[model samples]
Each structure stands twice: as C-alpha cells, then as structure tokens.
Target: MGPIIGMSPDKKAETPGKQEERVGLRGVSGGPGTLPEAEYGAASPLATSLDRGSGGSEDEELTNLNWLHENLLQNFTLGGAQPSASPLFDIEGDPGGPLNASLSSSSQRDSLKSKPPLSFSLLIYMAIEQSPSKSLPVKDIYGWILQHFPYFSSAPTGWKNSVRHNLSLNKCFRKVERSLGKVNGKGSLWCVDPEYRPNLIQALKKQHLPAAHAFCTPPASPPRASSPPRHLFLQGCSLQESDIDAATAMMLLNSAPGHHHANPCDPDSPLDLSRPDSVLVSSDPKQDHNYSSMALQRCSSRSSSSSLSSLDEGGPSPGHTRSRTRPRRAGSEGFHSDEDSDLGDDRARPQPSQHRSSPLSSSVKRPVGKRARREVTAKPELDEELKEAAGSLLHLAGIRTSMELNKHSAKSKKLNRK
Candidate 1:
C-alpha cells in the first residue's frame, strides 16, 4: 500500500521476501463508497512493474498489462470524447474481497473490442518505451519483459537468440555496438548516445509503428565533445602501434547512428548503436565481470586504454577521461538473451544453443569460490596447439551437414572445457 521498505521509485526495485499477503491492485466489487483515493490515483507495485519491459515473447503478457496501465493513466487529448473526464487511472481502488472475475473479464473484453488485437509493432514500441533510460542490458531486457509480460512463464528455447537476431536485422528495431566510456574518471557506464532514441523511433515508426511518430521526441542534453575517440575497438584488449589506425578502421567499420533520422541499415549506413547502448556497463567491477566483458565486446573496438595506462602513448589526452560517456551496447547472446544477428532485426533462433560459458562458470571443476577467478597466461605452444586443433576441427567439419548443430555442439564443448 505504501512504499516498500528500502525501495525507492528511482532506483532498481528490490523485491522483499514473499509475505503471506502481497499488496497489489484488485478490480472493484463494491460501489463508490468502498474506495480510498478512488478520485485521485492509486500507485501500486503492479503498476510500476508494468512500466519496465524490453520485449520478447516472455514480455507479451506482463508487458501488455503495463501498456494497459499506461493507457489508463494517459487521457486522450481534449478534443477526444469527454473534455474533463478522469483518465482510467482513477478507477483503481481496494476491493474488500476478490475482484468480480466476470466483471474483470468483461472489462478486458470491452477494452480489447475497443481496439484492434495487439500487433507486433505496437508490442515493440511499448517495449522500447519501457526500456531503461540508461539503455538496457539485453539480458535484463528479458527479465524486465517477463516482469511486465507474464506470458513467458516458460521462455521458448533460444528465444533470446531469436530476439537478438530480429533486433539486429529487423527494419523496425535499431541495434548497434557501443563502448563503455569512462564515468567520472573512476568507472564507466552505458550512456545513451545522442540521436539513438530518435533514430530508433523514426525507424520503427516508418515501418512497424507508424502511429508512434506522434510521440517520438528526445530530451535535450548539454553539448558533448565533438572530437572523435582515437581507439577503434575494445579499449583494453588489443592496443598496439599497428592498431593505431583503429580509429580509421572504426570509422570504416562504424558510422553515425542517427544520421538518416531513419532506421535503415545499409553497408553505407552508420553502425546501429542500439546493441551498444544495451551493452553499456556500470563502473563497479565488483558487481560482475561478465557484464563488463559483454559490454566491452559489444563495442568490440580497439582503444588506447592500455597505451595510456602503461604510458605506451607518448602522452595521454590533454582532457580528463573521467567524464561520463554514453551507453555502450546491447547483448543478448546467452540463453536468456537473443542471438547475435549482425545483419537483421530479431529472427527466430533455432534452439537453446549453449554458448561458451565464462571461465568463472567452472575452472578445474569449481573455480568460483570466495576469491575471484584468475585468467592464467597461456603458453605460446599451448595457444598455438589450441589454434591448430580448432583449425583442424574446422577443416574436417568444413561443410557440415548441419551448421547450426555443429556450432552448438562446438560451443557446448568449449563451455564444458571451461
């Protein structure tokens, strides 16, 4: 009924232990007198849950409720129907007993009849609306989807991969790779780069969500640095003198996200930043290294981080590097996420293909203890031997009878080895 202990509206919603009676909204049964704040609005946990989702089949059910909640809250313009009537939000109140099932069903049926059946485009638009302001982790997107859309009680195998593919190639969804820019000189976070939201809205509206154009607008921000970043790929992994022109390579490989103000991806079109935005990371390395690794890979660029850190570069940038950057990327590569569709919007993933699990998953049986897992330096010979083995496997399995199957099996083996 009131704010849950330690829970703030702005921060992540932390669920308390399951209580015998969980508080939520119940459709009315009694007459007007049985209400408290019926004239105003009654905010509840269910309503907040409805506000966060990033799409996928898992999000369909709960997310739809959230959409309904929004619909109830927002009134049609003054020109429509009654000018001074209250929005649907004021209808919520506490019912002494269970809601009238028949009444609730009828109201839902009427609402459904009032509008066309739900469309994929509308689902996507709503999902985008519910996405986090900091851009959303592709994995978190699914949980959020499930949180808001209860239909995915059991996510389809490889459903995440499918969503990822479609998101990449789907004309309506904007997907891109981004880097974790430093935040306050101490850490990094996924920052929503300028124009990304506008571009995605434009793209979706042009295709699946034509009606969305009316609501598409971006909040203005202060001026950002005009100069382009030097490194091209992942900042820490492979910085070298040979990699100096990473900027050029990055320029070649990447483009402005919202240059067209439309969501078209051509060879000439700029790299989509949606995926990168999704992959942005918080600076707290203590949280989970996998988030960092995944976010970094989304950017997949070469940067001068190592060079600057080691003084390999003659000098560091004249400006401080601690400033907050932008949301970096979006990754749904795990079973909970969608596939890596570098080409198109979300497409159907074949099955639950086991990706190569992180080393921390298990090292020599159970490497994850209270201490952090160490990435051991490999011997050159061992590295060469592994490469040779991989090459041989590829050569022998060159034209596999089932490419997808082979990839899954290979990935499974790799994960097992880790």
Candidate 2:
C-alpha cells in the first residue's frame, strides 16, 4: 500500500466548511480534528498533564449536571437537555462547554453550601419570637430574615417567593385577620402555632451557629428569687390592677372610645363596657365599700321623696301613703332578685338632688321619669290645648254673626212696610 489516502476528495474541496463544522461541534459528538500522531510525534509530558486535567474537569462538570438533573429536576431526562430547567443547564448554547458548565456548577455548589439547609419554618419562628409583640406579618418576616441571616441577604432572587410559599404551605404558622379598625394595606397578623413553638425552640438551640458562642453563653450566676413583685405606673399615678382578663384588656387597648367592641352578638347592641359618659366603679376594696354605702343612703332619700311627690300629685288617701312609705323587709339579704328589684325602683325614680351630687352625672344624662318625660316633650298636650282654643274662638264668632243677622233682618222688614 503506497500511502493510505486519509482526506476524502469531497472533504478537501470544502476544507473551510469542514473546519467550521468541526469547531462548532468540538465539545459534543467528538473533539477538534488533530494532526496525525506520526507527524506530530508523541505529546510532551507537560502538555499531556494539562490535557488530562482539562478532560478531568469536563467529566466532573458532566457528573454534577447529571446529579442536579436527578435531584432538582427529576422529570427532566439528561438525553433531551430541556431548556426549561435552565438552573441546571443552558441547553441553547454550548450545553457541555467548560465556560457555561463550570459557571453553573460552581454557582450551584456555592448556593448549596451558602444556604445551611436550615428549616424555613424555624427561621420564621425565630423572627416572630424575637419580635416585640411575638408576632409578625409576611413582609416583616422577609425583612427579619434578610436582616438577621447574611446568607439570605446575599442570596439571589426568588427567596421571597420561597418564603411566601413556605408560609402558605406550612401548618406551623397561623394567619389571623386584622381587626376592622386597622388601617387599609396593613396585612393580617402571623402567629407561631403554640404546638409548634417548642419544636422550633429546640431546633434553634440545636442549630450549629458560629456566633452562638460569642453571644448566647449561659449566665455565670442564677437570677435572684427574692425580688419583690413590681408594679406599673404612668407619670406617677399607679395603674390599677385590672379586673378584666387578657383578651378583654387587648380589646380595650385596640379600641377607641365610643366604638363598639371587637366581638358582639348583634350590630346594634355593642359590647362596650367602659363608656365615656359612664361612671366606672372604683376597683379598690375600701373605696368600693364607701361608694356603696353612699349610694344606699342616696337611694333611700330618693325613694322617700318619690313617695311624697306621688302623694301630692293626686292627694292619695293616708293608707296609700302609708303603704308607699313601708320600708323593705330586712330578711331578704341572700337573694339577688329581691334586692335587685327593690333597688331598681329607687333607681328608676328621678331625683334632682342625687343627679346634682354626682360630678360625672353632669356629663351623663340622667333618665327622666315617665310623667316628667312627657311634660318635657309636651307635643300631645300642646296640640290638644290649641284645638280647644280654636273651638271656643269659632263658637264666639258664630254668636256674633247671629246677632248681626237678626238686627239687619229687622231693619230690612221695617223699610219694606214703609
């Protein structure tokens, strides 16, 4: 055999086209065409080592891409090279080229390392627990994570979407609607589930924090147990111990004066207890007793006056006055209904003296009695009086007309006879 013909005549006719095709398909199918080994002789040791290193790197990138495809995009097959899963591969341009492959692999590796695989639920729980109210909204949660966790702040986009997704899907957090009084655009409140709180705390402690040693070490000494109970005050006035429960206190805190309470049985009937015009009973035991005594004395006096007024109105018989003056029997102390009814009648009767004595009563309108109320309005009585006056005037006018008619008729008859 004289010399084996290597280059085909058809390929030789279009060498430039062939070279371009080879260059384009270098990484895929086959590598770039090389000079005959006989003419180039054996490759140098340094060159061989460099080539081996590059080949090894390419193999490693392919391995990584395969792993990502399996784990992250399970539906994607390596053969098809789907562009939809762009995070794993760039299917459009040089899918296996070192530049694109290395970049993607390093990025994926760094992200995997940077994100410490901490549970998102745990992160949310920490943010809320550390918040002043032990509650936060979704946007606030995002802010807190970015502020606290450097990894999150440095992370690429889509993290916020992840946060929203986790919040909606996770059962460990509860979304409560804001009160009707809250301003618009102020979103609902997010609270950690009580059942999940313990688990989240444990997870936080177990978290391998590099900064924990610097910040969260245990105290050297135990806290003092002999400390006295403390009291709260505002501008020197000691706040009274509230008789209401926590929920009621919260409702009162959020609500403004004159507005209905947050929850009620009906639209018209409000649940508000501390009205602006109402007189709040003192909570102090000593002051409360004194007030009760004063109120009892006032009621007795009012009742006596009411009986006298009723007697004067119609001049009822002596027996009726005696019956009205009879004091309540002393044996009915234990029953609520008997005592309530007895007090109710005295309270129902209007007394100018009691109303004048109460300072708060000046602002609070005291209820009037049935008779006095009608007198103050006087609509029906005024109408009746006007009607009677008009009738009398009309009767007088009719008699005057009859007298004139009789005189005129007598005069006309005399003239006719003449």
Candidate 3:
C-alpha cells in the first residue's frame, strides 16, 4: 500500500466521468449550491432565453445577470429567509418557495374570481355615488354599471336582477319615492346612505382599482353646439335715426305755415333747418277752387238776383267798395217777419196796401267771410236748357207765392167774422 504513482491515495480516484454525472445530478435535483433550469425559466423568462443562446460573450452574460439581480431584488422579496444567497443563481436559498407558490396560486384563484363579484347593495351604492344627481333609480343603477364598468356591459341578464335584489335587501342603500311632481314620474329614486359613503368608497376602491380610474370624471358633455341667436326673426332690414329724422323733416316742411309758428328747426321741434324748403308747397289749387265754389253756392242761394246781377255787370272797384260785403236778410239779424207776427186788432180795420214782404227782401250788408281783393270771378256757364229750367222754376215760385197770399187773406176774413 505504498502510494500508487498515477493517483492520490484519498479514496478511489475521483473519475472525471463520475464527477460530470454528479454535477448533472445536482443540476436536475436543484442541489443546495445550484438553481434548477425549470425554476430559472419560470422566474425570469429573459434569463431562460439568454441561457438558451450557446454563443453569448462572457461580458454580455455578466451584464444581463447584473441587470436581472438589481431589478428583481428591488421588486421581489426573497421571503425564503436567506440573506446572502445570489438573487439570480441560488435555489435552496428559497426554503419557503413552495409556500410562496401556494400563496401566489391562491391569489391567482382570487383574481380569477368574477370581477370582485359586485354585491347588489355595493353596486347600487357605487352607482349613486357616481351619478350626477348622487341619486338614481334602481333601473338607472343597472344602466350605470353597463356604462362605466365594461364588465357588466356584456354580462348576463342575471346581474340586473341581482342589483334589484340587493337594493331591496340592503339597509345601507335607501329608496326614495320620487316626488309626485317630478317630470320623470314612473320609478322610485335610489340613494346611498350618506353615512355609508365612506365604506362604500373604500370597498369600491378595494374591488376595482385606483380611485382615479374607478371613479372617472364623466366625459365632458360635448360642448353644446353654440345655439344661433334667439332673436334672429328679422332679416337684414334695420331702422336708423337718420331715416326717422328725414321723414319727420318732410312732415314738418309739408305742414301749414300757421303750424310752423313753433319754428320746426328749433331744438324742441322734430324738423331741422338742414332739411330743404322745396318739400313744402302752397295749398293745392284744386282744393282752393273747390272751397271757393262751395262758398259761392251758399252766398248765391241766399242773395237776390238783383245784387248778383249788379256784381256781374261791373265788378266793384276796390277803392269804392272798400267795405265789400255779403248781403244779409233783415230777419236773419234777430228780426222776425210780419208773417210770423200774431194778428193785431188794427188788422180788423182795413190797413194800407202794405203787403207783408218776406224777410229776404229787406237785406243789410255784412262783410264777406274771406277778403281777397280780387274781382268777382266769372260764374260757371249754364247750358241753354238749364237756363230755361231756371226760368220755369222762378215762374212756378211766383204763382205759389200768390196762392199762399190768397189763402192767408181768406183765413184772415174768417177770423174777422168770428
């Protein structure tokens, strides 16, 4: 037993092949000093892919390993109770890896649970909190879930029934009967109890996500399309002060001179001096002519033919007829006719042949209604037939007058006899 020349005397010489086998065994079994490939792949997909490349440089491998160590150690806890084990290389370093796996699986199970299974009461409360009115009908809660939470948009029909069930059963949510006068009359309004808001918000946050995402701001109402002006009734037509001023100026210019006593251009008057004078003209010739004709008719009918003829023969000279006047009947000036007088006793005795003349015969002169020192205007011509008709009428008038006188005499005689 003297030392063999080719091998150390410690046990049987450790053969390279046996050592390789042992190393392979250690890799498969995840020995105390080494990590298994399956778990390495599971923990870091990047590391697994890197390891698959057989030709990677040493520096590149070392850099990648550093990155993995820094990033993973920062984010994940080793929870396996080993402080110095390499985060990327050690396997048994995690004694509690199985417990962690179980925890992760259980959490996965929890995540797999149906979207935090919104209890009916919780759903109603969330809906009311997010509603613009902070109150909603139970039916609206169903709709709100569909709108904000896409999970419910494609959900089965049972969710709405569940919601109604929860509202009915939950003491945390309140149902307010819509006032009778409300415009939306059919359904009761649903409200979350204010006291429960804190709990509801916490629960919602726990179930859904960050408060910001869970309670999203309602999309800004699409800016109401700017409405057209309400009082767009008129067309382009418009009135201006200048137009009114011009019209007023025309009116004042056309008004009578007497009406112009208050100077129209005065600040108090509507018209201004700037307006043209040509707008005003004298009275219409035709109107003056018609008025003169009317006056002639009135005067001619009351005057005797003798006075008319005198005027027609020679118009009065302005100087001699300085007091040119209209003719007036005596009775018209506060005098009554003898014909209107009661019979006197002297009427029984035969009186002088003083035939009672009509008050029209005794006429005194009065000034004409209007004084224009013009010659008498020529009368309108009468047709031959008209002259004849006028003569016949006068003759008939004389005969009627005589008959009336005779009747009066007979009546007087009869009275005398009585």
Cα RMSD, each candidate: 25.5, 42.0, 59.1
What RMSD does model 2 have? 42.0
For model 3, the stretches where C-alpha displacement exceeds 4 angstroms are 1-117, 180-182, 205-418
Model 3, residue 337: what's the lDDT?
14
- Stretches of candidate 1 above 4 Å error? 1-103, 106-132, 170-196, 199-418
Which order, best to worst by TM-score? 1, 2, 3
lDDT of candidate 2 over 52-142, digit per residue (tens): 2224333332222222221112211111123222211221122333432332443323322233234566557655544434456777777
The whole-model C-alpha lDDT of candidate 2 against the native structure comes to 0.30
Q: Against the hidden reference, what TM-scores do the models get?
A: 0.25, 0.24, 0.23
Q: Which lDDT tens digits does candidate 1 get at residues 222-326?
A: 212221111111111112212212211121121232112222212122222222221122232222212222222222122223222111111112231211121
TM-score of 3: 0.23
lDDT, residue 14, candidate 3: 28
> Which prediction has the highest TM-score against the true structure?
1
Among all windows of 10 consecutive residues in model 1, the one with the lowest summed lDDT is 227-236
Clashing pairs in 2: none
lDDT of 3 by residue, 30-145 (tens): 21211223221234211221122213232222222222222222111121112123222222233223322321332222211112233445546545544434466766666655
